[model samples]
Target: MYSAKEAVSANNISEQFISQMTIRYLTSRKLVFPTKSILDEERRINSWLGIGACGSITYGRARIGKTVCMNYVAESIRNQYGSREMVIIWNVTDHPETERNFYASILMAMGYECPRYSTALILKERVLNELILRAHETPFKKAVMFIDEAWKLREKDFYWLMDLYNNLSGKDIQLSVFMYGTRELKDLKHSFKLQGKDQIVGRFMINESQFFGIQDPKELQFCMASVDKLHVCMTDYEILSDGLVDFYFPYADGKTFFDISNDFWEAFQSVRIQKRIAAEDIPMKYFIDSLVICLNMHGKLGNSPIAFPTRKELESCVALSGYGESDDEYTK
Candidate 1:
């Protein structure tokens, strides 16, 4: 009877240990690394908002971190200039197929009281008037509007947007517009070539940044360092080991945690060099997702700690991230 009780207790402890080992303390969503791509976008946005009466477009492959870059830059700008002075309106144009919907979306993001009963033309005027009114205020000096998923914009929507841009600039409202989308934005701009949409085409073409991902070696290193800053830990071990520092959160590579910087960068290079992954194929989002997945996989391996991602595993993560197939290799 005593032996059986001891056996049951041991099994129970084993189950609890497994459960604790599998717990992931970090996620990609929580940590937004300011890589080169993000920094470049930030600079462009700052310049646009700084001068006023201009707009910028950021387009790239799917899951390339364009939206994240925009959000991070906007937040940074807002922080620098208090909330009252710098207003950022974000609208994800998922199904905003009409002009009124676009206006309503912007108004909604700005927290304005938009009546549903109003016509699309009224909504457009309302948004423009609101911007004009804010421009007159002492506290409001700059307003930035971010329209994500802008590839869904139709030809009519382009005219509507151009008109809005013209109206806002005409009022001298100090407005900076940013559109985020996929490569389709380029196709849309091309369509306007002989269609007499020169104004709209010129506005976007003037200040456009193409974000493919981190391609340069130095930039790659910087990205790895940014990942290190996240400092994902084994929370279960932190609690289980009590006050002992040594037993708390062993390195994923079984070495020092900082080794992840080189390990991740090297693994990525190997995959790309072998042609298993292309340079353009590895975007910021996939890299981030792969890192998070690798970290969780390492944490799950109870005693065996493999520090960095294996090529196969990394490739698999990229595949799962929806950017598996190489569309085109980035050229110098």
Candidate 2:
């Protein structure tokens, strides 16, 4: 056994060692999915609104890359629409700000320069004016104001949104608003109260996307390959794809890829540092144990609604009696 200091000076250590592995893997280049969904929800949005001044809302479980996806969508919009500088993306969940304050934030994101009025209603109107005024300059004038973590917005906020849509109703200006978050913002419309205002709910034509399930088979293999990249010698094994996919999601549940990477890094580092698992001799037992540790740290063990005995599930046979059934099945 070597002391912490002595281990550093020791030779033949693995190259995967890092001074600080506590940070999220977003900092480690995990956010860039080499291939992304080209048009995340554009087809659907435009399909819903054929004429002009359309709107869309995207919703999904928390930490499932909804924020990142929305950003990608915004970027794509900007790229397609050359004068896309008009589009604004605003985040409104931090510090418990209300819809009014959020309007102020949106105004700020849209380059609101007027210092004349500071009231909520005034700010909202002024923001509309800026967009309206810009649209008159060029027919290509368009803006997609993406409001993130919008579940925090109460029903009262819907008024401001309605006003926004109505204001831009009759102009060459196109306002495509994108709202995303965890709320049953979908279910919010079905409520008896909101039913009274069906027209209001009809404004955005919200679309829902949930990441509550395991990754697709293709994605699972890619995820494992990404993890394999962290290893200098540990090659990616395809034999365990089905097993690992279940393990990862049920363990990390709805976490993003970055979250899973960070989560795995921390758990791996903790187990290796605390018990001093050597670089070369790290066993499969320790690897599984570290994964279990990550599951525990991320607060998601029993949270999984499904379970499996890897031996029985993977090999399709009981392990009892020297895995007698497994042996017989293998022979056949």
Candidate 3:
């Protein structure tokens, strides 16, 4: 069992290794796109899970696929452990604004009953008691509590986390907390110091994974290739060997998927060049949306031997969809 750092450094990926890795580990009954960032985040979470009862934070602006990446990691961990029962992943995305509601959310995720009008103390007790019971009776002894939208947590809510952390300490069932939020999460941390909550801040600082959009041309290529490798449900054909760029309606000349991917990459670069946006300005959401739109367009070719978008069609879709818009503008 290699540490996360060891695994990341050891599995350093190059273009040559991606195909092999994809065929061996990523391909299954469903599509599992493995990029460098996704793999690195998985390794870090796995390492923290092994160590147990720690905290990690993944923060970036919205639409960077932070939650999506975490979902992949959670599913991968459950599958690798051979039993979903062995690892419980609770996503607290719509968690309540209050502490009691927060504890209620955790209790509900664990299937613990919390009667109406239950006090915060009672809710906390129920959660801790259930965790302890699971350690002894259930096969799953480890848990991951994901606090998405963590920036929404108020100052008093920090103590709620501290209480949960303290209660879980010295117990057989180790837990790891992952905080997912935007840049404001760090500001929340800084405000904690003013409130003299250094310990809570320290707990969350154990590991920080910075989520990002496409940062370079290489990453853009990697992401596009990952999308290109995405398997369609209908056919048993191998896109890796034969792509649909030229074969599809927009370009019936039958260019390869790699060729199509190169075209998509160039379109993004073209946006940067023509719009004068920074080289790294492309957002992950825009890429995802563009790919989805292209796929939907390709799906229009029902029962066709190949399904893909031409360079011209892809460029048109991305531009029309406003994928090249700046993050602030998109957010607004």
Please write out the lDDT profile of model 1 over residues 1-332, one tens digit for every residue. 11222433644554334333423433334456677778878887787777764676778876667777777887887776666434555656566477778788778877877797999989988888877765565455566677777767677776777787777767665667788887887667667776877887776556777886766667666766554443222323322321111222344335433444555556666655655544543577667666555544544342433534455555554445444445544431
lDDT winner? 3
Rank ordering of all candidates by TM-score, starting from the highest: 1, 3, 2
**CA-lDDT, candidates in order:** 0.61, 0.47, 0.62
Specify the poorest-scoring 10-residue window by lDDT in model 1: 239-248
Model 1, residue 240: C-alpha shift (Å) = 14
TM-score against truth, every candidate: 0.74, 0.54, 0.73
Over the full model, what C-alpha lDDT does candidate 1 score relative to the true structure?
0.61
| Candidate 2 segments whose C-alpha is farther than 4 A from its true place | 1-25, 28-30, 34-53, 94-102, 111-117, 133-138, 192-194, 206-214, 224-332
Task: In angstroms, give how far residue 96 of model 3 lies from its true place.
Answer: 6.3
Per-residue error for 244 in candidate 1, Å, reads 16
Candidate with top TM-score is: 1
Ranking by lDDT: 3, 1, 2
Report the C-alpha displacement of residue 220, candidate 1, in angstroms: 2.9
On a 0 to 1 TM-score scale, where does candidate 3 land against the true structure? 0.73
List, residue by residue over 1-332, the lDDT tens digit for candidate 2. Answer: 33222433554433123111211331332343322232436554445333554665576443335665666666756665555666677776554445557577667777665464577777777778877865554456665677787666655666777777677865556777777765465556456245687555667644444322113334433443554333111111102122223333344344333334433334334443543433311222232233333333332233432332221122211111122111111211
- Give me the runs in candidate 1 sitting further than 4 Å from their true place: 1-30, 94-97, 112-114, 133-140, 232-254, 273-277, 300-323, 326-332
- What tens-digit string does per-residue lDDT give for candidate 3 at 285-318? 6676676555445533333323456677678657
